[model samples]
Structures are given as structure tokens and as C-alpha cells.
Target: MAVAPIIVHPPLGTGGRRVTAHGRILGLAYSDGDVIEFLRRAGLPDAEELLDDPSWVTWRGGRAHHYEAA
Candidate 1:
């Protein structure tokens, strides 16, 4: 199965998280639920599935960010 890629940048100065899909910025998220909500708003087919998977990691720089179960 093909998985949709979710990219998360470092936290903003204002404490919001930037989320991206396909190189396009979705929006800023204040929490994990906000991330998922943004993805859903963006119409990503696998948004829920992606977050539901415990193995999924939002990558930053050249490494995976620490996983925090939603």
C-alpha cells in the first residue's frame, strides 16, 4: 500500500507546528489533533490512517521527530 507523506517542521516561534504534505504547507498546528484536523481539511486520502499508525513519524531535517502517540 502507498502511504501519504506528512512533513512537520520545527515548532514556530509562536509555538505552532507547521505541517506539510506534498511540499505544500497545510497550516500551523497547536497539537497533534490539530495536525490531523489540518490534514483532514486538506483532503488527504490517508490523513486519519497516517495518524492512526503508531509507526508513522513526522520527519524533520534529516531525522524522525520523537513519536508521541496521538
Candidate 2:
């Protein structure tokens, strides 16, 4: 399967995940909204929708929408 260009890395011990697009660090996202904003700033046409799109976003080490890291 083809991987998504945007990668939302696992949440850190302190909190929030590292967001990257093609290895470019966008910002740290504590919530989905943060991710959208970063994408919007990065010039993504439909930033918010990209979250639900598997072909556009990849959530690693945790379930989507769950920020609590075990």
C-alpha cells in the first residue's frame, strides 16, 4: 500500500505528537486541530479533511484521536 505523505508520529512522554510532511517537521500537535492548522499553514488545500483520509495522514503508535500515551 502507498504511504501517506503526512505522518503524525506517536505522542511524546510529555505530550503531543510530532507532525511531519515528507520529513519536514511542521510542528508539535496536541490535538487534531493543531495538525490541521499546521497543514493549512503548509498549504494543504483541505487540511481538516486530511485527518480522516488514510491516504493523506498516517497516525503512528496510537489510535487516531486518542492523545493519551500509555
Candidate 3:
């Protein structure tokens, strides 16, 4: 058995406060794609696969803050 790789996200810029996703602190990257990529690269294959899902809402600044559960 081998350990999986982790891609830690930078820090979220939510009015100076950190955002919590799945109970973990989120980091703000330069773009939303980065955040999405971070989720994928962070050993979350399902996160990467959801990029094309209609529920995925990526803002203009690469921020997916308005994500709604579908």
C-alpha cells in the first residue's frame, strides 16, 4: 500500500475570514480554477470530476463561493 499525494489549497479571502469546506479551512488562490484544481490535486478525484457538473458555479474571479448542492 502507498500513501496518496496532497495538494493543499492556499487560503480563502472571505472578508478576511477563512472559509470552511467539509470542515477544513479553505485557502484562497489566484483563480477559481486553482481552487478546483486544488481540490483535484489534493487527492479528491471526485472534486475534479465535478468540474463539468451543472451544479459547479465558478465565479469570474475563480471563486466558487456560491456552490449549491444538487
- For TM-score, the strongest prediction is 2
lDDT of each: 0.63, 0.89, 0.42
Pairs of colliding residues, candidate 3? 10-27, 11-27, 11-28, 12-27, 12-28, 32-62
TM-score of candidate 2 against the unseen true structure:
0.91
Question: Candidate 1's residue-wise lDDT over 1-70, tens digit each?
Answer: 5534677777655566678877788887667677778888887556666764534435553223323333
Residue 10 shift from truth in candidate 2, angstroms: 0.5
Best first by lDDT, ranked? 2, 1, 3
Per-residue alpha-carbon lDDT of model 2 for 1-70, expressed as tens digits?
9989999999888889999999999999989889999999999968988898999989999788766666
TM-score of each: 0.60, 0.91, 0.34
Q: Candidate 3: minimum summed lDDT over ten consecutive residues — where? A: 2-11
Query: Per-residue lDDT for 60 in model 2?
Result: 93
Off by over 4 Å in 2: none
The total of clashing pairs for model 3 equals 6
Q: What are the RMSD figures for all models against the true structure? A: 5.6, 1.0, 10.0
| TM-score between model 3 and native | 0.34
